[model samples]
Every structure is written in structure tokens, then in C-alpha cells.
Target: MDVYIRSVNVGRPRPGIEPRGRDTAIDKRPVASVEVRDPGPKRGGLGSGVVEDDVVARRHHGGSRQAVYAVAREELDWWAAEVGRDLHDGVFGENLTTVGLDVDAAVVGERWRVGTALLEVSGPRIPCATFAAWMGERGWVRRFTERGRTGAYLSVVQPGRISRGDPVEVVSRPAGGLTVPEVFRGLTGDLDLARRVLDAGILDDRDHATLERKVARRTPTDH
Candidate 1:
């Protein structure tokens, strides 16, 4: 089955997308289109082969694990009402703005054949100060987190051309794999959910090490 790619966006060349004082590239805008490619081993990172895109905060974003970010048009519509304003595609700095897709509900390890590319759901986007500033909503970070509908990040499996209006195909989904939202709570110190994220066997060793410390601080809770 195919889904609609409402818009394909990339970071426009701006003073910066990071908060006023920081360095990052989170202010993405709808591009007429873009070329998507797999960076493969030993390249820049997630945002690597994805041409014309920006990821100034290299330490925090990009890599094979987070090659692309996706947010559903439906989620943006919900936020528009919440803020009492109109929100557009790419407002959340997403690489792909899709329609007719419950992106957050997608299971981790799910593969979507978008264009000629294959992308696997890796995790969720963590709300950050850059995001807050971009949205121009005070307490936006807290509000977005509370919504628990964070967008998903994907890793390029078999990269190819992607453009606006491309249809997305759900090639396969991992049975019982962690979901994008669960990954969000997991990284946010939700103990039981964090354990589930860990058991999903998706985290890189570096991520595992960071979560290990948090896992120690929180007592186990019933799932």
C-alpha cells in the first residue's frame, strides 16, 4: 500500500536553526524536492548522503541510526489547533511530511519503501530548545513531550530517490518491536518503558551506556 508524501523538506540556509545562542540545524523548510541516498559505512552520518540537508549539531543528530526524520501531517494538524494557529508541513524539522500515515504508531524496525528507498524506524525525535524556538511557543518543549506523540526517526536501508508526492509502502514490520513513542518515553526516563526500549535490541552501545545510568536511578515499575 502507498501513502502520500505531502512535502519533502530540508533545512534552509538560515543564520541558524539552533536556539539563538546555540549551533544546530533544526529549521527545515519545504524544498521543491531533495535527493536521498544511503551514507553507508564511514560517511558523515545519518544526514550524510541526504543532500542539501543540514545537521549543524552533528554530535546530537545524524548518523546511520537517524538518517531521516518523519512527522505526519496529521500530527501537525493537531498541534495547529493546540496552538490556535496554522502549522505547515516541515514545521517540526521533519525530512518527510507524510499524509495518511500513523507515523508515531509505526513499530520500530518497520521498513517503509518510500520512493526507491527503504527506511527502518529507529526511534523518536527528542524535543529540544531548537525545536522550541522554531515553534515560537513558550513551554513548547514540555507541551510537546506531554503530548507523547513525538515523530519518528529512520535509518536508510536501501537509499534511492525521494521527492514530494512519493507514495510510501509498508514493506514489513518487526513483530512486537518498540514503537517510536515508547522510545520517546524510554529516553525520557520512563523506567519500565526504558527497559522495553533496551530489550528491543535497537540501541547502539553509546545509547545503551547513557541509558544504563538512568536505569539505575529509577526503581522498577510494573508495565
Candidate 2:
């Protein structure tokens, strides 16, 4: 629908992007150019990255499923109004800030063509302690969770260079798919919606396994 990349952000993270916080690569700043790396299908799955974006928390971040983090610029504007402060593009910890795209509503299996690269929607960004600390707002995690506008995490399907102003078009989407917001809420106590993600079959194995484990843990025992 004519979505375009608003800003390409990467991070040169230091030990202390924030005092008393994890060395998250979330403090992304705008970059003039970004060379998206897909690693090809034989290598496994999509992984998008610019030259400057570094991964400090390797254990929890930087995999095929969570390759690139994206948030719609409109959502950033919404947070700006709600928090009574001006929000900038990179301030939300997004690697690629998009304009005119409903990121939260994007289906998990959906693919987008950006520049010469192709990216697939893996899932939504689940808020964590690092994200909470970055915001520095009281009840930030709860608020963000309730909002359910969690940004999408993308996998590079076809690796190539991508930069700001690149046109984004949906290449394909799963049939009767669940949206990003649905998956986010499902992770956060919504069993019905969470189960739907399994049915979609487009999510990464790691994420799908996580949900499978959770469901197993909650299953009813024989009476």
C-alpha cells in the first residue's frame, strides 16, 4: 500500500547507553545507509542488519526471528502525545522506522519488499526489563503491554541494501492470518490469540517452540 522507510537506524552501543541498564542495542540512531543482510535460504532464515547495528545481548537478541526491529512512525507519534513529550524516530529502539505502514496489524507470515531486500514479519516485540528501563516511565511495561501496538520484528528474506525513503510493498501474506497485535497479546496472557499463532505456521521455530512449551505447561490433567 505504498509504505516507505522513514529512517534507517543503527547503534554503536557502549557499556552504558543508559546507566544501570543492560547493554541493549536498543538505543538505535539514524544511519544514512544500511546494507541489509539476508544470509540466504540455505543458511537458514532471514537476518537484517546495517553496518553500525551491533548486538551486545546475543543470548536474547539477534537471531533469525528477531533480526530487525521496526515500529511505525505513527505509533511513535501516539506515544509522544500520551507521554507528553516529543518522540523521535530512533528513540523507540527501532532499527527501521516506517511511515504509512500498519506494523501492528501486519500478519506474521507477511513479506515486504524494501529496496533490493525482502523481509518477513516474524512476530511482535515483547516488552522486557531493558525496554522498561529505557522508557524511564512508571508502569511503562504494563502501559505498553496494554496498548498492544508492539512493533514488528522482521527477518530478511532476500538480503540487499536498504535506506531511508525506500518503498515497502507487501510481497505476500498468509491466509486467514493473525495480526502482530494478536500475537503480542497472546504472549501476554491471552491464551486464545496465542494459540492462533501456532495455526499461522509462519513464525520462527524458536518462537513457535516457546509457545508450544507454554501451552504444554497449561494443559489440563486427567481427572
The predictions' CA RMSDs to the true structure, in order, are 3.1, 2.9
Q: Which regions of candidate 2 are displaced past 4 Å?
A: 17-22, 39-48
- The alpha-carbon lDDT assigned to residue 220 of candidate 2 equals 80
In model 1, residue pairs whose N, Cα or C atoms come closer than 3 Å (at least 3 residues apart or on different chains), thus clashing, are 45-63, 46-63
Best candidate per lDDT, number? 1
Clashing pairs in 2: none
Q: Which residue runs of candidate 1 sit more than 4 Å off their true CA positions?
A: 20-23, 40-49, 220-223
lDDT of 1 by residue, 1-223 (tens): 4477989888744664456666556767887677777654323555544778877666667777778899999999999999999988888889999999999999989999988888888888888888888888989999999999988888888878788999988889988788888888989968989888877778877888788778977766779
Candidate 2 per-residue lDDT, tens place, 41-77, comes to: 3133332355557766655566677777889999999
Error of 1 at 39 (Å): 3.4
In terms of lDDT, model 1 sits at 0.82
